[model samples]
Target: MKKYIQSYLGLHLIFLIIAMILFLPLLLNGELVTWRDSQFHIARFHELIMAQQNGHFFPDIIKYSGTNSWGYGLNFFYPTYLFYPLIFLWRLTKLPVTSILIFDIIVVYFALWSNFAIVYKITSKIKLAFTFALTYVLTAAIGNAILDNVAVVRIAYMTQYASNIVILLAPVVVLSFYNIIFLHDNRTWLRAAIYSSFAVMLSIPTTLGIVLTVLCMVVVAYFKRQLSINNMNQLLRSVLLTLGLSAAFVFPFIEQRLANNWANLPNNPDLFGANFSTVLMRIFNLSNVLSLLIIGLTALLIFYKKFNYVYKILGLSYIVALLFLYSNLFPWYLFNRELSGALQMTYRWHFMPAILGSLFVAFAVTDLMKIKQKMLPIVSVMLIYLSFNGMMLNTVAKIAMLMVLIMQRTILLHLTRIILKPIHCLA
Candidate 1:
């Protein structure tokens, strides 16, 4: 028991140390880096707290009589889900905004850690798990999206911060799903419920993606005969519990908002109008660069029949996501606009498949290494080095590190065969 505890602590310590180092640049500049969306989220949180202090249970929307009677807006309501915990902390210790910013970093770190641990448990390979976790958290796309719109341009709004929180929670969602599906542990059912509920409360956009993924997993499990009666009962109960808990907070605001005209609510058009050619181009563009290496690797694994049942299920989920991306109905768009009204944006929907594709690739690479006798350690080292360097540096440095990763993978295969022949004979 002591040994197990020690092992867990050792692993967590390593993850924390690496995560902190990777996030150091952002931590140093995060306070100064104020995006409009982030500012909006912070403002909303402050507004809610102020309203609470004034003995109001809900945020009072200020309306100008005989002018713009825009009705009571729920813009301030979004952050309440994230702010409640912070408010508790603030009540215990009267810290300023700086403390909240620090708290955000800590929360993000734990989110990343939980995400990586979940991936590791699935793949049972430390190197691949670490690589996927690091990449997911610090992906160039995420950085580009955040830095381009939020940090440099000073767009302070709720979406930016909310998206970050969503990204952090994504792993938790995936992990919970993995636990319930593959491990079949009863504890995982409760965990999945809690995590999924928190995910929905954090950002409806991310939660929408997660729901679709869950649906796909459920369908696949049912078809594959993997869903036992016990598992099905657990899943249903968990979903019900999550919904009931969330409704306690969500129903009042939803009722209030829906009392106003739901049809004429804000609509986002950017999600629609992407033609087949454009969708193909986007997929191709991701593939041309090494960005979609994981996607390619997943395909290769499926082709070779190397993937296990669990991996096959995840792989099918990715395929379903792709099909949805191309479908005429644009289910993601409909779901997003329906749930959050003006809050749903189209371009961000790609994040769902991107994460799943990366996980698939990680699994494929690890499985490939297992089959190829001698290349495992070499490729593992390369991934570790690249993950560290990639996290610490910016564009040019990251590019160089990625190139090194590719070259190492190529050379290690040949080196493995040559080195293992003599050792095999001696053995």
Candidate 2:
């Protein structure tokens, strides 16, 4: 036992150190970095605190919240299972906002640690695992989807929404589904089911993501001829377990929405008449150069003569994920019209590529590092470019900047090598 613990101690220590560094502002400054939906989420946390104090452990209506204090059913409509830890911390500390902030930092750490541990479990390479984990956690910042100054821009700001939970558990779901389907690992299906349940409990957008992620995994398994009766049975067991586990939220949410005639929430999808360029822009902003690297790696893994089963699965999953991302652009929607309405924007599918693409880049970069050390200069330039190019910039501007970046001597040379001998570069 002692030997086992010592062997894994480095990962734990690295997680803690990086977490503290990332969360320094929230901890030392004693404040949250406010952004889109921050106020609404803070109020949700406050309602939880209020409900607990009023002796309503699981209040259907938060009488202390809503317009004119008429009692809001926010808790009834949205699952708060993910926030129980925050509530517990609030009870212990008696500091409502502080407790929420602390819990936010904790969740960030959990997200980082989970991604790191899972990649390591699959690859058994500490450097590769840490690179993937760190980049995945900070993808938003790396892509300039959030602020440039902050290292963890999205995480620093978006702590209030349960969407964070969806992001946190996405990698786990992907990996478990891969294990159950491709490896015939029946034991992992239950784990996948439980995490999928947790993910779906959050909201419609999250449920869509979890369901689609599993579907993509299964589809890829089938495409590769890895799908089997046992795989199907394991998947069935996973679905049943997921439904049973999520019933607490599923049943009540359905009941309340139906009883109150709130079933038809406005979807208001913005992609109805969006042109090709517009859709491309959305995908481009989804992860910037990370998306390019993923596309490159996935192609190599899928088409290369020497097949890599693990990466091929990841590649197929990314391809399927792209279909969903582009589904909104189609004349007829791919998902149920009603369900598609739940996603205000089609880019909600970004979570899928975010996880898979980061893993792809991790595999690519780690291999490149081993094979040709000289390519490090181009990788550095691309990383620098990603940091400076904000997501809000126009598509043309981003492309222009990228073209300029590619014109650099080192990057230009690397691009040539990549085009000429992509397999050699990756392998």
Candidate 3:
């Protein structure tokens, strides 16, 4: 009990330090207030608060062009979905929107911490799990998304942040789903259903990614004869429950959007003449040292025969599919022009894959470390090469430095243990 309390306190201290480090710059520079994305969300929250005060439920029509439109126009306030809890706080206490903004940032960090705890549960390595979680939060995808949001002042695009929050929950959702499908744990199925439902509610694109990943897992399970009839039944039940819960929110939204001719409607063609090459370039352009680390580590794992060939192949296939989706391929291809038109610019759709790549790297790194061989130098060189890439260059550098610091600490701890052994015997 005492050890548990000490560990809890230690984690809290670590989180506090990390939060301060990430938050200090925004606080000191006063950029937090002026950040364009921040202003837009704050504005949307105020609008919602005002509507609530006037005895209206949440406003269906968010003014995008200084006028409220019902169907066709973008609802810029959708990103504020998670902030529904904070809405109550605003009503009860009448706190300034800025205060809520600060609070939300803290919430995001806490969400991140929770995500770290989940990863640790799976990996059973606090350091590696925390490293993976930190990488996810501090990656260039997040930094760039925030920077763009601040620069663009488009609240509608806050979907990026929403997607990020969903990503933080993904490990837990995936693990739960795996347990339910493979182990047939009834309680696990219920929990997984709830988590999956929440994930689907958060972002459709992310939900689609999760579904695709599960499909891939299912195929692998089938080929390996790892799935039995009972397991399949439990998996189906979990998925059905998740889908049913999600349909409550999803159906109405989809129907409304469809009726109103939503932007990026299905069956659209490539209006911008975008080809596979352009999409590929976008993928390469977004690639960073961390991304390279994931790729390299994944390759090394396969080469060393650490993972089964099928699992390794599936991992690689998933990465490729992610890249394809990010690129102007089938489904995303159809909507590329429409989304670009709505946003008034072309942003790399590859951002999610880049973020997911970190997890692949984490899994690979954990596997590699377990093998008794010289792998550090190979990873180090790859990191150096990746750091040379120009995208989110500074953040990538920080990540690389953090990894190095961690490795150095491990080495020092080992050496200290070795040096102390002889002295203890002599004493």
lDDT of each: 0.55, 0.61, 0.53
User: Can you write out model 3's per-residue Cα lDDT over 1-427, one digit (the tens) per residue?
Assistant: 2133138676666655555544444444434334344454566667667766676564556643232333333343133455677777777777554345455456546745765666665556765565565555444242233322111111112334555556556655666656555554545667668767876665555555667667777787789787888888878888889879867566666667667654442322443234675544333332334444555565776688766664465456545755465444445655555454333222223334544565665566656766834443355334323322211223554454456567768989999999999999999
The superposed Cα distance between candidate 3 and the true structure at residue 243, in angstroms, equals 5.7
> Tens-digit lDDT track for model 2 on 349-403?
4667677767766776666655545443455345434432321222544465455
Please state the error at residue 253 of candidate 2 in Å.
3.3
Model 3 lDDT vs. the true structure?
A: 0.53
Report the C-alpha lDDT of model 1 over 288-383, residue by residue, as the tens digit: 222455556657666778757867776676555544654444555545545545444443444565576667655666677666543334433443
Q: What TM-scores do the predictions have?
A: 0.67, 0.72, 0.62
- Cα lDDT of candidate 1 equals 0.55
C-alpha positional error of residue 153 in candidate 3 after TM-score superposition, expressed in Å: 15
Number of backbone collisions per candidate, in order? 9, 1, 2
Best-first order by TM-score: 2, 1, 3
Error of 3 at 265 (Å): 7.1
Show the colliding residue pairs in model 2.
267-341
Candidate 3 segments exceeding 4 Å error:
1-9, 33-40, 63-67, 70-81, 89-97, 121-125, 140-159, 182-188, 219-225, 240-289, 295-319, 328-356, 364-427
Of 2 and 3, the candidate ranking higher by lDDT: 2
Superposed Cα deviation of residue 404, candidate 2 (Å)? 9.5
